[model samples]
Target chain A: MTNWQEDIVLDCSGLNCPLPVLKTKKIMDGLDSGQVLKMISTDPGSVNDVAAWAKRTGNELLETVADAGEYTHFLKKRH
Target chain B: MVETAGKKKRMALIASKGTLDWAYPPFILASTGAAMEMEVGVFFTFYGLTLLKKEISPKVSPHSNPAMPMKMPFGPDGFQQIEWPIPNILTGNMPGFETVATSLMKQTFQKKGVATIEELRDICIESDVRLIGCQMTMDVFGFSKDDFIDEVDIGGAATFLEFAAEADIQMFI
Candidate 1:
């Protein structure tokens, strides 16, 4: 998958559920519309939680790549 | 996409337990719901009102909780995976067993990167999730508003019901 240019990179490695999503929302709130964020998390639950959060909050989830136990997600801030 | 009928989704939660295990769900859901753009309110009633206290220290009690698996938080993966089947007699009669259990559970949560209850509550406050303490409970328990965190609003059942009435999801946790 093509890597989208990210305005900020959030490393949530070793953090569990809700923290990753909460921190992601915090940073996303500070970004301009259409800006992309790259979030890396080691929590397995985030694979689904981040997608669900982006969907519910109307953010754009560009891509998610899972390598070993780590998951990398690219999300775009919605207007 | 615009909300259906242009109404924002709302979630109302009634927290009635004060144990360490019981405390996580309400705060976790409240914070997550707020992050999802939903208005969230958690009503702390009965023992749950203790959670709103400024110095919140919830502990796990293994006495009656037979299903709670006891595991060492600090160990190799294989060692950590082994669940020690603690006898009910020992857990029930042993002094300081509850404290040990609470610390072990906390250590496990920390090792697995779970957020503390305080952290989750802070996030909820930051996200504008309403933290409502039951007025009747405080009066019954002889607690003052000063006992709780400043971010919490002290209210009666009616206040929570008003929000829960308009909420899309309501849970008694």
Candidate 2:
């Protein structure tokens, strides 16, 4: 519904690999656990980078969607 | 660029022997910062510069400190099943352990098609993340300016300390 962790939009446009996760950590820090963080990234590798980071960092991968020319995903801080 | 107001974002990858875990933190954090739109810098000193060395590691060390970041604990057949330096001081405690992790990371990235450190370095420059090589460490390690990857500025603890002071996130790997 409203304020899902991913709903907090963090548009990481030009940033590549490790940055997406790093950025996600920064944004997530401001929110409570169970809240979602939505990320909009242009880097192709971000698809896997974020996924791997979420797993490594103990975050939740609520969703990962790929649009025409972009990748979007939601990460919920579980820890 | 969107302003990350009140964002407690800062990092210094203070690396000593440049082992597996040590190498990843700074860059991983640095890249993470750029992604988060936070200011990031990498201060490579001592053996830590080994990660940024022109040549990356080839494979995991089957010998010393064999356990390392511990292969992520995949399964019985996975690399983590092996032994590594647990609770041991990273530097010199397990010689060659850092080397193994460094190279294995590179190989993993290469296998995964992740961006190389050199590539990440380029992105760091564009994102305004400072990439500084420790002058003192370089000298002691007998590393010439040429030995390091390009586009790194030379500085010592003071230089990095300034960053660490302002940085909300700092890691000594």
Candidate 3:
């Protein structure tokens, strides 16, 4: 776990594929290095989509939790 | 691309069909872009006009692509991964797979409270997102000037190309 595992929260509930990922990208672009973004989404594809964006955009997925059918993806932008 | 308060993104939605799957990327991007206040436009060509047609636009489905997608037994919207010979069709005139996918999306968005086709068109209009109907394609497809929604601006390939080229961000979906 990284230090950023506890900081930003982006609740993208009711959003579907691509929007969540696209919104995640926008957030990551705004934050500084080491800042974290926690994305809350109801889209089932977000797990794969966020992971793919992280891999492609050089961000890091610190952790992921799925509870009560909601998915929360934790990501730390790589410097 | 025209400048906005935040970031400016120029997107080119090459809407080729009116299928639900095909309709999505454009609508999502347009709505999301406008929601973010970005200047966006979608150029509808071929069968994509159904998105604006009031009489039967809601009923529009694929007349070609067989591999169009919808919700699956255990996955999300348009997330199912299957391959076909073409993006919107396989081998015949049958709507086949794309129908299921598009229909499901309509249902999903309705459930999720996103705008309907008409509402989306209104949003695009109010948001200043350009909705251009392909003039050449319309001619090629035998669509008259009266065949489109009132919001669409008719333009030929040269016009669209010029407009698309001037955009800071462009995408052909």
- For residue B131, give model 2's deviation from the true position in Å: 1.6
Root-mean-square deviation per candidate: 1.2, 9.8, 7.9
lDDT of 2 by residue, B45-149 (tens): 777767667775423443454454545333455564565545556544677765655566666556444565556555566567777888887788788888876
Error of 3 at B48 (Å): 2.1
Model 3 CA deviation exceeding 4 Å by range: A1-79, B1-7, B56-105, B108-115
Quote each prediction's TM-score. Answer: 0.97, 0.53, 0.53
DockQ of 2: 0.16
In angstroms, the error of model 3 at B52 is: 3.1
Candidate 3 displacement at residue B18 in angstroms = 2.3
Please give, for residues B1-173, the per-residue lDDT of candidate 3 as tens digits.
Answer: 11232445566566766755567667767765654445677787777766756454444354443444323333554554433334334423554544554566577576664556665566567667788888777778787778666777888667678777867666666
Query: lDDT by residue for model 1 over B39-150, one digit each (tens)?
Result: 9999999999999999999998988788888889986889988999889999999999999999999998998889999999999988899999999999999999999999
lDDT of 1 at B40: 96
TM-score pick, better of 1 and 3? 1
- The Cα RMSD of model 1 versus the native structure comes to 1.2
Interface RMSD of each: 1.4, 9.1, 7.7
Query: Per-model TM-score of chain A alone?
Result: 0.97, 0.83, 0.90
Badly placed stretches (over 4 Å) of model 2 are: A1-79, B1-8, B19-21, B55-59, B68-114
Superposed Cα deviation of residue B95, candidate 3 (Å): 11
